[model samples]
Target: MAEQNVPIQRMTIIRTLLLFLAWFNQFLSMNGYSPLPFSDQELEVGVSMLVTFVVSIWTWWKNNDITKKARSRTEYLKGKGIM
Candidate 1:
């Protein structure tokens, strides 16, 4: 239970940070100072979509890292007959 909660707690912190970043990005876009500079397309669909895609990929990577770590620990303990 302790080990399980540990990863979950860390993941929660990271998720909150990502949510804050997403909201910050949205606020910038509404105010006309989005990260990607291009006065022509204020409603830059491609740029916004790109950021969203990147965030998705990042989240997927984080989840994968967590899974790999958990698996490695589990396997290590099992190999030593500690599990």
Candidate 2:
């Protein structure tokens, strides 16, 4: 059976928002303005933690999606006696 060429969506709005936040924080610090309550170092650490957490979650979600797709494909092949 021919494989179904479905494209998975890899881009997430949450990640983009996180990236924008980090960039905006840096931009604010560079302009000598502390828009947030935390110090620069503290903000960096906090943002770093957020990034790590988001990345972990995203990785798990993507892996889950891929696994589901693989299982579906496998079952399809088995149904067609192609496995």
Candidate 3:
């Protein structure tokens, strides 16, 4: 059970970092600055962040759906006096 939580924790950290990066990039752009003094680097980081955000949302949705189904099944079984 604890082992199953590791991935979720890691993903949470990754998502936080990615969001920070996205915000940092926007701040730099608004201030006429760049992290690496390169135009393309910021664009790459933005694209990567967009991809990560989409993937994270998809993963969360799937996980939530699965958990909901599992919980409902457990409740149904309990109602039937099976466990």
Candidate 3's clash total is: 0
Model 2 Cα lDDT, one tens digit per residue, 1-83: 99998765557767888899999989998999887888779989999999999999999876663676788987898999997
TM-score of each: 0.37, 0.46, 0.37
> Judged by lDDT against the true structure, how good is candidate 2?
0.86
lDDT of each: 0.81, 0.86, 0.83
Q: Model 2, residue 9: displacement in angstroms?
A: 16
Task: List where candidate 2 sits over 4 angstroms from the true fold.
Answer: 1-31, 66-74, 77-83
Q: Which 10 consecutive residues of model 3 have the lowest summed lDDT?
A: 1-10
Kindly list the per-residue Cα lDDT of model 3 for residues 28-79, writing each as its tens digit. Answer: 8799886665569777998899999999999987666367778898789899
Output the TM-score of candidate 1.
0.37
The numbered model that scores best in TM-score is: 2
Candidate 3 stretches greater than 4 Å from native: 1-8, 36-83
Measured with C-alpha atoms, the lDDT of residue 64 in candidate 1 is 64
**Every model: Cα RMSD to truth:** 8.7, 8.3, 8.6
